[model samples]
Target: MNKCYIDGSIGQCGHSSRSADKAAASGTVMDLKKDFHMNSGAGDNSYARNSKIQGLIISKSQSERRKAAVAAYLGTGRPATMSVADLGCSSGPTALLAVEDIMVAVERACVELHGQPPEFNLLLNDLYGNDFNALFRSFPEFNSRRQGKGLCFVTGVPGTFYGRLFAAKSLHLVCSSSSLHWLSQMPEELQQKEGSPAACVNKGKVFISAGSPPCVAEAYRKQFHRDFTTFLRCRAEEIVRGGLMVLAFMSRKNREAALMEDRYIWGLLEDALNAMASEERIDSFDAPFYAPSMEELEEEIGGEGSFCIRSSDQFLVRWDDDNQYSGTGGEANVTARPVKHAVRMAKGVRAVAESMLRSHFGEGFGMDDLFCRYGGLLAQYYADSEAAVTNVVISLVRK
Candidate 1:
């Protein structure tokens, strides 16, 4: 177990005044490899079961993904064997969907140019603790469905995408969906400040929100800038010239990070925690996440100078789009009831955040109670407003 600093003496921000002293007293380094991952298995709380929202994200980016694959194959003169990678491919049915989409695009390009499809080497990457076993269980079905049309080999590579995960000029195409918004780690400057009135700099919040201090937003922005730059630099070294990358992740339309819909979800969660008298549990717990604007993303890519943007677009996603609690009566009636909406929201949030919550709050914290409160909060919020979340999808080519 990693050492947790939730003793009210430390903060979630990485740069507390007494951070040096605290670190010296307890030698612990944040290990994202061990910390980050979707909840494992096909259980009710598992990411695999509740990732329909991510699937929707993948569906929306299909055109971009296909275009990138085709461009990559044609640009490379239809390599006999194409190398492809999906970074942050968490465990779920959707894990292999991107691979399949790429295969279809490449195969179509091959038929249009050559007579047949090229052999494919597909790599699925995620954090080390990801539920890869469950991910692999779907491969046989995937292979069988392929019907021997193309010789494709699928493998899992566990590690952070913020660093180099493949050899130099080894990859022809790279894609990521519903990821990248996740920072490699929390911003070091956001750590809890000693002798501060509040336990954390970003009090009562796990992520940047309208209520967050300007310094909190700046910290997140800096962390994202650094991490995204490193990500592009690493990919630039690994991808061959003319290779393509399609990235689709959550983003805010507004320049101000606090006004984003994504941050409101965390605000609601914070409310739930506070209601449970466990606000202190999240005192030193900053979520390693950020939803960048299109401008921010373009700036990073341009500054990196390794890739040129081919196309970019933003889309809105409603929270109730994938409501699983719809009864046989009708969609409108089901969504009208607060309980059903709350249940769906709870499951979706729990799937992605259970690991982080568990790690930060420890086992003694009542997960059921916390999510119940969260669900109620979500219910009330949705009852009053029907806002949609925003996401940006960008296609790029190595220069």
Candidate 2:
């Protein structure tokens, strides 16, 4: 079939149209919806199990999420029916974790007003390749805990968030956590074919790293602006005027952090890959990700013009290093913790990034060796470095 829709107005599917849109690309030659899922399943190294880091990030903004949900509920006059969405909702506990936060907040508001909560139309969105089965299999436990929240209906809408997914002004509250940094597609300049004159060789790196030319970072910055603006525009159409929107994602505090500094995640991965295979031998790959600064986010929100920033916050979360977890650092560090933590962190990064890595490098490439070496590099650097990521969460309202 050429078209598919759920609950009457999800989205129409068409490849010809997709190939025609061209606002972006994912690295080189990859359909993000097809190649971009986190490692699926309930395996030991799965994203489901390795997502505690993201959960911690989400918890940091729990208060704001609730406030946004309640504001949307009240701003919409607390209608008999309410619609909310968690965009970029890759599969795992974190997916439901976000939905639960909004549900709890809105329910508490209803209780305060001595009114019955509206029917909760909770939409879960992500790329099509995501494992919705695993997400839903974990639902009974979630539903059991969700009692007294409201009559909630969950629908999985698989598509890119950079484009519109819902009908006009249909959503009351739109919340996305740990997801916005993913661009809709790779920067056009970076994706040029090998022999093409304008091709940008961000050579020997998965992302903009220590030796990347300034143009590499600039291309990424411009792409982030374009995709983020598109994201805001699409959401504005789906969310009612004055509806609340909350977003939490990885970010940087300044230019140094944005430059990869050898302490960044992707930079560390590049080191591992370079050690495994010489830099010249490494595949020509670019990751479809970017971490924007706080100022950049505010500028985009204002420039997009559809959403006004109601509030925003920036916080730091340490990498999941064992020494930090055990309160051991520098000389007192439990040497074993770093090793184990390195492997654990390696798995966590793999779960989220392996799909893109595999797609770019192909099935025959050695993933185990990559992460193993990556763990070593991570351990070495994080042992003596703060190496924390700046998470920026913004609360927005349709204008």
RMSD of each: 7.3, 10.2
Q: Go through the candidates in order and give the clash count of each.
A: 8, 2
Error of 2 at 69 (Å): 0.7
Which residue runs does candidate 2 get wrong by more than 4 Å? 1-28, 255-263, 277-283, 320-324, 327-333
lDDT of model 1 at residue 102?
A: 93
Give the Å error, residue 2, model 1: 32
Clashes of 1: 8
- Model 1 Cα lDDT, one tens digit per residue, 1-399: 111112111112221121122212121334667866888999878898888878888988899899989999888777889999999999888899888999998888777765678899999999998999999998888889899588998889999998889999999999999989988887878765455444368777777866778888889999999999999999999999999999999998988776666676788887666554344545566788899999989899999899999999999876556654444577667455554555666777788887766666654556666676676666677766654678999999999
lDDT of each: 0.78, 0.76
Reference-based lDDT, residue 95, model 2: 81
Per-model TM-score on C-alpha atoms: 0.88, 0.87
In candidate 2, what residue range of length 10 has the lowest lDDT sum?
Answer: 1-10
